[model samples]
Target chain A: MDKFLCGIDLGGTKINTVIITNKGEMVSSYTLPTLAHEGPEKVIQRMKETVYKVLEDAKLDVSDLEGIGVASPGPLDAKKGIVLNPPNLPGWIDITLAKILEDEFKIPVKLQNDANCAALAEYYFGAGNRTKNFVYITISTGIGGGAIIDGKLYDGANSNAAEFGHASINFDGEKCQCGSYGCFEMYASGTALANFAAKEIEKGRESVIKDIAKDGKITAKDVFEAYKMGDNLAKELIEREAFYLGVGIANIIMNYNPEVIALGGGVANGFDILYPIMIKTVEERCYKASFEGCKIVKAKLGQNSGAIGAAVLNIVFSKN
Target chain B: MDKFLCGIDLGGTKINTVIITNKGEMVSSYTLPTLAHEGPEKVIQRMKETVYKVLEDAKLDVSDLEGIGVASPGPLDAKKGIVLNPPNLPGWIDITLAKILEDEFKIPVKLQNDANCAALAEYYFGAGNRTKNFVYITISTGIGGGAIIDGKLYDGANSNAAEFGHASINFDGEKCQCGSYGCFEMYASGTALANFAAKEIEKGRESVIKDIAKDGKITAKDVFEAYKMGDNLAKELIEREAFYLGVGIANIIMNYNPEVIALGGGVANGFDILYPIMIKTVEERCYKASFEGCKIVKAKLGQNSGAIGAAVLNIVFSKN
Candidate 1:
């Protein structure tokens, strides 16, 4: 009998669960709305249901599973597998999802921050497999990052190592939610793009984004659409965001000299639109020799990266 | 018979050579004027003389030496042991110092950037021995840096991995010699401090630094002395420098999450004066959990760090 593992990508809006073979090929999968506002117990119940559904779909018994791995938004305690008030899932203070899953399934469980999971997936299956050192950055509702050094995840002293978003790009640029000024995320995240678009609309800068958002609630998608329609204001806004993103990414490159930099998350969907400009700015700014030929590539696995990464964690940990 | 190594720390003004056991116990040492203006051949001859003197003082023959390591300023090629147009050593372009030394003594020789050697010395004998990942920064006329990962030096794609000095702290703040703006070295180096002091003096700010530098050749040492005597302008200058330094260092910590940060070089001599303020700024700026318990320590071995690190390169390369 092939050993199997269950993986969960726990997001604020949804729960995605998968059953995979030891090689990390997904055998079956299930998805459900998180209904996180219903609180931790309800979310946990939904998560448990999804895991069982995935196993049943694969025609496997619970006894066939070797372990379960969870990837969640963090400010979490991975050692204890507790999610400590992740910003996206408000009121989720110290939810021990891993321990509860282990209890319900009678199997070992592992937990990691979602960004770290994405990095693991990229390391094993995406752009980073060719190098031992790299950084993975996900730009969406908020920016998140993870690092790989000498072929292992660098979790820092408290398992909070790769806070690349909080690396300040400007000392006095803008205020961040983390009570810092000029964080890279403050200027380059999807939220920042939306905010910039909304501010431009408020200033009566004529743009096609207004037509895309008839309700006047501008989003990053609206901005991208407007840019595609040749809206000068939207193009300028995206160019500014890409400039900051490029500078921030260049800073990471200069500091770490990673062999590759993997871009992931929702904003990466616009990678083709944004990457050329980002590369141009980085080339103009970063040290020439170190960054030359350093690959900047979009993440391959998309929505499944977190779940796949989580599944691989069991394999990685067992080998270690 | 015990195996021994030779180290040469070649500086613009001086040359220091030492003979030591493989265990790092110094057996004999000697120092002499570099006379770098005398050109490459004479400097190489002087370096050979210093090495011979140190060995003679220890009563050891060339046969006793396993190898030699030379540490010099770069843009040199470490792989081929060539010093390529280092700014301080004018006209010394593409000189293969390592090959020259090896030919004279019939022992293998290795070359490394001076800052990298200092980092290696710290890793082997100073604050860094306890951890495999760390960054060593030397704040002198110009800032220089090295990285230690997995208990070994990382030379990057072009042997320039640890250009910590060139990493941008502010993307648009000040112009740097490397054709970038707001590099960490532009704002935090000893050269930057002196430049700031001179600009302040030019603006007619009242400070004792002007009195100390009767010839108007202000230096970082003058700025420190004035601050020590409670000159308000000097205090403000130091504060600004510390803030930029903290920003840069915090960026490094956030990106690499190194276990320790070792400060070295001439400006590090005043670390006692700068420590409290530097730590305060770093704590306020960096991610709290990632930096907690991460040490900011003074580099041991002082002036000998480069030479000691150079000696160790023989062992490091041999193992590789």
Candidate 2:
């Protein structure tokens, strides 16, 4: 029997399930709206349905699968396979996701933080494949990170090693959701870009952004659009954001000196626009030797990276 | 026959040599003035004499040693065992101290940056002994750091990983020697503290520090002393320095989430005076979970940590 593994990427708005061969080639996939407003039980049922649908699409029996892996936003207890109350997903306090999935599927289940899954994906298939030591940073609504040292994930003493977003760029600057002031995320995340655009618009700056958002609800996409349209305010905001992001990256480079830094998530879709600026800023800030020859590249797996990486967790932890 | 190892710690003011048993127990140690003004050859000879004297003090012959390890300031090539233009040791550029020592001692020689040696010492015998992942930061005249991940030193791609001092805390802040602005070291190092004090004095701040150093030469020691005497200016300066240090530390804690953070060097000697303020600032800035149970302790090895750690290099590399 061809052994297969299942992976589920559970997000705030959706759940994606995929079944793959041992070699990591996906055989079938399924997706479902999370409807998290209905709560954990309903979400879990939807996840199960997606899993069953994926397996059915592959014409595979449950008995043919080796195990299941799940990737989700964290503060999660990965050892116990429980999801703690993540900021993005409310009312999810102390949910035993792994146990519930295991009980339903009668298969061993592994759970890891979503950012960690992305790092694993990068290590196994993305830019990180070229180096044993690297960091994967996903810049979306918020910045998230994972570290791969010696070709393995580095979970710190509390299983929360790479919280790169929370790293302070200014100790006495703006307040952050984590109750800190001047965290990198506060100044450089997609949310920060949106906030910057909104603030600029409110300051009476004339731009195409105001036309795109009649209700004054600015988004990162709108900022990028205005930037493309040659709005100076939008351009300046992105440049500033890239500068902060670059400083944060330089800090990471100095501290970890990873051979590669793989960038993922929605914001990285702007890599072409931001790469040169980020590179210039980072090069100017970090040690010359440490920055030399270090590869900074966009993540190749895109949205599927989490699911693909989650499936590979079985192989990774099994060895350990 | 029982094996022996030799370690040489090359410093700006002095050279320390120690003979140790294979088990890392120190058998004998000696120190000599670096006489850096006499140039590399003379200092190298003094280092050789100290090594031979220490071995003789231990009643051991040179042939009984397994290897020799030397720890020196970097901007050098460790793989080539060369000391390249270390700022403190003027006129010592591209000097192959390792090769010379190896030729003289007829044994294999290993070289490492002194900061890395301190980290290795901490990892093997000091505060980091129990933690597989930690960062060792030395806040002296300059800030330097080493990272120990999974029980091994992380040298990064160019053996320059863990340049913790270079990590930026503010993009437009003070300019550092490495040509960047707002580096952690620029705001947090002992030298930085003194610089802040000097700048304040120049600005006509009223303080007892003026009485202690009417000659216009200020040191971090003077600031600490003034703070002890309840000098408000000194207290404020120290508090501000501590705040920067704490923020830098919080940045590390959030980004790396190490199991422990070991503080070392002469500046760490004032840990008693600095600890509370630093901890308070970190508490205000860091994520709760990242710092919740993380241990921050003063390095236990004191001044000899570099030599001892260098001596242990054979064991660490061999075992790995």
Cα displacement (angstroms), candidate 2, residue B313, comes to 1.2
Give the winner by lDDT. 2
Candidate number with greatest DockQ: 2
For model 2, chain A alone compared with the true chain A gives a TM-score of: 0.97
Question: In candidate 1, which residue pairs get closer than 3 Å at backbone N, Cα or C atoms, i.e. clash?
Answer: none
- Per-residue alpha-carbon lDDT of model 1 for B1-320, expressed as tens digits? 76898999999989989887887889999999999899988999999999899989999998898899999987777988888788788779889888888889999999998999889888887878748777899999888888887677876655676677887777777777776678888889999999999998899888899998858899999999998899999999988887777887787777766889899988888888888778887887776666684789888889998999899888888986
For every model shown, the clashing-pair count is 0, 0
lDDT of each: 0.84, 0.86
All candidates: CA RMSD in angstroms?
2.6, 2.0
With candidate 2 superimposed using the best TM-score fit, by how many Å does residue A76's alpha carbon deviate from the native? 1.7
TM-score per model over all chains: 0.92, 0.96
